[model samples]
Target: MRPGLFASPRPDNLGLHDGLLAPAPSTPNGVSSQATDSKHFVAPLPMPTDCCVSAMEKLHGIIESLGHAEIISADDGYLHAEFHTPLLGFVDDVEIVCNEQEGVCHVRSVSRMGHSDLGKNRQRVEDIRKRLEGWGYCC
Candidate 1:
């Protein structure tokens, strides 16, 4: 498949609102730490002993190590990245917000265009979590 052949335009409802990332959509193609429904909910990543900025930096490194990931925007405690599948090149948006007070990093991952992702979003997040754990950070 051609790259981005199935990619949809970036959604307007991304980023943190009122100190929380946007909720996951009511579809199986998305997953979010802030989601209320079990089907779309994933636990936030536990912050390390270092500062939130450090955690974000570490997270940035992890994302960078993953091929086909493009950093869209990164702020002090927030990051947005797009991941392309190896075969079809389908795009998936990933957003992360560091909550210093809560000692966690909230994350959201959603397919750009699809009714179901066959659990790709969740698996991606889990893969990230595992990588973070390798750096001595726990979820």
Candidate 2:
């Protein structure tokens, strides 16, 4: 398939709101640490023992190391990235927000267009979790 043949326009609600990332869509194409439903819920990443800024920096580095990933915006305690599938260039938006008081990083990953992602979003988040583990960070 041609790259980005199925790419959809980016969603307007793509950032944190009132200190929480936007909820995952009702469809199965997304997953969120903040979601109340089991189908869309994933445990948040535990913040690194260091500071929020340091954790965000490490998270940013890990995302950059993943080929085909693009950093959209990054702040002191928040990050947003887009990961493109190699074959179709399907875009998946991943957002992370560091809650220092809670000591966890809220995450959400969703396909830009699709009814089902076949677990892609969940897998991507798991992959990130593993990479963070390699950095001596644990859940």
**What TM value does model 1 have?**
0.91
For model 2, the run of ten residues with the poorest summed lDDT: 1-10
Q: Model 2, range 1-139, lDDT digits (tens) per residue?
A: 2347667677889987787888899899999999999999999987854578877888999999987898989987889999888877889999999887888889999998879999999998999988987885532
Point out where model 2 deviates above 4 Å.
1-3, 48-50
lDDT of 1 by residue, 11-98 (tens): 8888878888877888899999989889999999879545788788889999999878999999978999999987677899999998
Count of clashing pairs, candidate 2:
0
Superposed on all Cα atoms, model 1 deviates from the true structure by an RMSD in Å of 2.5
Q: What's the lDDT for candidate 1? A: 0.87
lDDT of each: 0.87, 0.87
